[model samples]
Target chain A: EAEVAQSPRYKITEKSQAVAFWCDPISGHATLYWYRQILGQGPELLVQFQDESVVDDSQLPKDRFSAERLKGVDSTLKIQPAELGDSAMYLCASSSNQQGPYGYTFGSGTRLTVV
Target chain B: AQRVTQPEKLLSVFKGAPVELKCNYSYSGSPELFWYVQYSRQRLQLLLRHISRESIKGFTADLNKGETSFHLKKPFAQEEDSAMYYCALSSFGNTPLVFGKGTRLSVIA
Candidate 1:
């Protein structure tokens, strides 16, 4: 089975430090998403990308967080000056297209902890 | 706003017992509903979608438009079925999915 790849399974960073997470979606997937999951809450979308162009980033915190998919294939999410509240699991998912019954495929996720 | 709601945060069932995880949604337009499951130390994966109307691992979900619900159900639960299940909704088009808080199902022997 083709799986989404994510780097740095766990990360611990001090406040005011920068942290980044990487994700490589399955081949042929066109829509990629970045989501943040708090300890007790469901995952929330941070950004969505259609190929290399961003489709929606309304929930993303622009001041401190940034995400990009340079080649429309792999993506990277970065947080500057990480805050304690930023501790959570960052998940990456991808789908072949906007249509179809095949739901998104998610990566194992990168667990972030800011102290 | 589109939203998915899973009323129960945790549910427990004995092996061989029937299981149902409730899910409701608030969407004005035609919506797509899905159930995603995450096992221990595993990535979240799609268990089933309302569009498919197919049973997977003995699990099934029926989309009730009038009730605005798409609840996951299984005839008999197994110990391996214990996992965190999330109900998600997506509006028409290429919109992103909105997920509920999720329910932790524990099937004990």
Candidate 2:
């Protein structure tokens, strides 16, 4: 089955350091999402992209976090000056369209730990 | 604000027994609800959705707007059913999904 791909399954960084994660959604998916999941907590949406354009980033921390989907096919999420509280699993998901029988397919996630 | 709530964080049941994972949502509009499952060492995947109204792998979820609940149920649990289940909701106006904390179901044989 086609699945969402993510890189750097695990990362350990010092506070204030930089970190970048990548995700490649399933082919032909129009919507992509970035979610941050802290231990013992639910995943929170940081950003949503629709065909290379950001549809929503209301919950994204603009000052420290930046995400891009230049071609609408693959996406990258970066955190400059990472904080200890920023440690969590970064999950990327994709959907074929706005709605259907199918729902989102999430990646295994990249676990980032900032010391 | 739209939100999802899964009351129990951990649920333990024996194999061949019934299982139920409760979920509630705080939304005021027509909503699209979904149940997602993540097994050990696996990525999260869709389990079922309210729109389809079809049972999958002996699992079923009914969306109750009046009570703002979408509970997942299975008549008999299997060892393979041990996993983390999340309840998510998508509002009528937005495509972004709001997920609950999740319930970790452990089927002990």
Candidate 3:
């Protein structure tokens, strides 16, 4: 079974530093999403990309957060000048537009801690 | 905006005991619900969806539109069922999956 791939399983950074997380969605999937999950809470959508174009980013903090899917196959999420509150697990998920029984496949996520 | 809620943060049950994980949603239009599970040292994966109505690993959930709940139930809990289960709802196919806080189920041997 194909799965979403994410890099940097763990990261430790100081406040005000820039951090980036990468994700390669399942092949041929038309939709990809980036979510932030605080401990004990559900994953919150940060951004959504539809075949390289951003579809929804209302919740994304544009001042410090930016995401790109130049090729649509892989996407990258970046946070500049990170704050302590920005520390959380960043998850990537993908799904086909076909509306199959199986909805979305999520990655293990990148655990980030900022001091 | 679509939202999912999993009220139970932790649930403990003995082996062979019945178990239920509660989930409720807030959505306007017809909604799609799903349950995803993550075991220790493993990736989050799909467990089952309400549309299929098929029981995976003897676990089943029925979507109740009147109550706005989709609770997962298992007749016999197993130790392997110990994992973080998340309930999700997708209101629009063009949007992302909205997830709940998740329930941690521990089946004691």
Candidate 4:
């Protein structure tokens, strides 16, 4: 039962400050994803990565948000000049296959709050 | 665009009662459907997928292609079954999942 690990379970940052969240996917997982879950809403995809290359980031706010999997084993998501509306639960997930009946494994998520 | 729709925002049922969480989708081609559950103080995890066709924790969902629906159901609900359930859809290949607004199930004793 390997689990995805996330750092900084809870974070509070001032508006205009930078915030970053880290995620370490399960060993041998090739695909990783970053999602944002707003209160009372389902999680939305921010970015998807296969190994170190990005597969899809159409929904990601390129101006303020960026995600990278430098080594492909772990990944980081950063928001520059965080805004109040950016407060949400950032989730990370990993899977061995791109699409299959065996779904991805998700992390506990990092709760972000901007003041 | 692939989309998943979970109609009810919240569903409350008594323990030992049958439970059903409705879900519908809109996809042009064949898509994969999944049910993810998040318990209190726990991470989101996969409950079951339509492709598997296997019941988990007494829960099962049948994919109805004509109606474009994949609803999650259980014969008898338990208190521990209370959680937030999300319906997700994904196309073939390395596509990101599109999730619905989820339904909160409260199995009251």
Candidate 5:
């Protein structure tokens, strides 16, 4: 099965450091998403991208977090001055349609830990 | 605001027993409901969706509009069924999904 690829399966950084995660969505998928999943919580949307444009980022902490999907394919998410509270599993997902039977396909995720 | 509520943090059931994971949602617009599962050491994946109305891995969920509920059900649970299940909701168009905290199902032998 085609899978969404993510890098740096696990990362640990000191507080206030910068961290970046990469994601390569399944081929032909147009919509990509970034989500943060805390220890005991479900994944929460951080941003959504349609092709190369950001569709929604209302929940993203713009002061420290940023995401970009250039060329409407692979994408990257970055956090500067990462805080302890920012430690979580960052998951990337992609889907072909706004709504469909397949729904979203998720990556294995990058587990972040801030010391 | 679009929100999903999964009341139980965890549920334990014996093998061969019926299983049910409750989910409720609050959405102003027409909603699309989905159930996503994450197995140990595996990536999260789509288990089923209300629109498809199909049973996946012997599991099925029916969307209830009047009660605003979409509960996952299985007649007989298996050890392999143990995993974390999340209930998600989405509005029309390219809107992002709003997920409930999730329920960890532990099917005991």
Candidate 6:
């Protein structure tokens, strides 16, 4: 089975530090998403990208968070000056344009902890 | 705005017992409903979708337009079914999914 790849399974950073997470979606997937899952809460969409163009980022904290899919294949999410409240699991998902019955395929996620 | 609601935060059931995870949504237009499951130390994956109308792993969900609900149900629960289940909604366009708080289902032997 083709799986989305994420780097740095776990990351711990001090407040005011910068952190970045990488995700490589399945081959040929056009839609990619970045979501944040807080403990005891469901995942929340942070940004959505179709190819290299962003489709929706209304929920993303533009001041501190930014996501990009430079090549329209792999994506990277970065948070500058991470805050304690930023601790959560960052998940990446992908889906082809067809997007049959089943929804997007998710990555294992990168757990971030800011102290 | 599209939103999904899963009232129960946690549910416990014994193996071989029937189980149902409630889910409701608020959407103006026709929305796509999905149930995603996350097992211990595993990635979140799609379990079923209302559009498919196919039972997977003995679990099925029916979309009720009048009540605006899409609840997941299973005839007989199994220990392996213990996991966190999330209900999600998506609109017609290429929009991001909106997920509910989720329910932790614990199927004990």
Among all windows of 10 consecutive residues in model 3 chain B, the one with the lowest summed lDDT is B89-98
Error of 2 at A82 (Å): 0.4
TM-scores, one per candidate: 0.97, 0.96, 0.96, 0.97, 0.97, 0.97
lDDT of 3 by residue, B1-109 (tens): 6789898999999999999999999998999899989999898888998989999999999999999999999999999999999998877555677889999999999
lDDT per residue as tens, model 2, B1-109: 8999999999999999999999999998889999999899998888998989999889999998889999999999999999999999887544788999999999999
Estimate, for each residue in B2-46, the C-alpha lDDT of model 5 and write its tens digit: 989999999999999999999999997789999999999999988
- What Cα-based lDDT does every candidate model obtain? 0.94, 0.92, 0.91, 0.93, 0.94, 0.94
Off by over 4 Å in 4: A98-101
Worst 10 residues of 6 chain A by lDDT: A95-104
Model number with the top DockQ: 4
Cα lDDT tens digits for candidate 2, A1-115: 9899999999999999999999999999989999999998888999999899999999999999999999999999999989999999999999877553255789889999999
Error of 3 at B47 (Å): 0.8
- Which residue runs of candidate 2 sit more than 4 Å off their true CA positions? A98-101
Runs in model 5 with CA error above 4 Å? A98-101
The root-mean-square deviation over C-alpha atoms between each candidate and the true structure, in angstroms, is 1.2, 1.4, 1.3, 1.1, 1.2, 1.1
Count clashing residue pairs in model 6. Answer: 0
lDDT at A74, model 5: 99
DockQ of each: 0.67, 0.60, 0.66, 0.68, 0.67, 0.65
Better of 2 and 4 by lDDT: 4
Clash count (model 5, backbone only): 0
Taking the tens digit of each residue's C-alpha lDDT, what string does model 3 give over A1-115? 8889999999999999999999999999988989999998888999988889998899999999999999889999999989999989999998887853265778879999999
Candidate 1: TM-score? 0.97
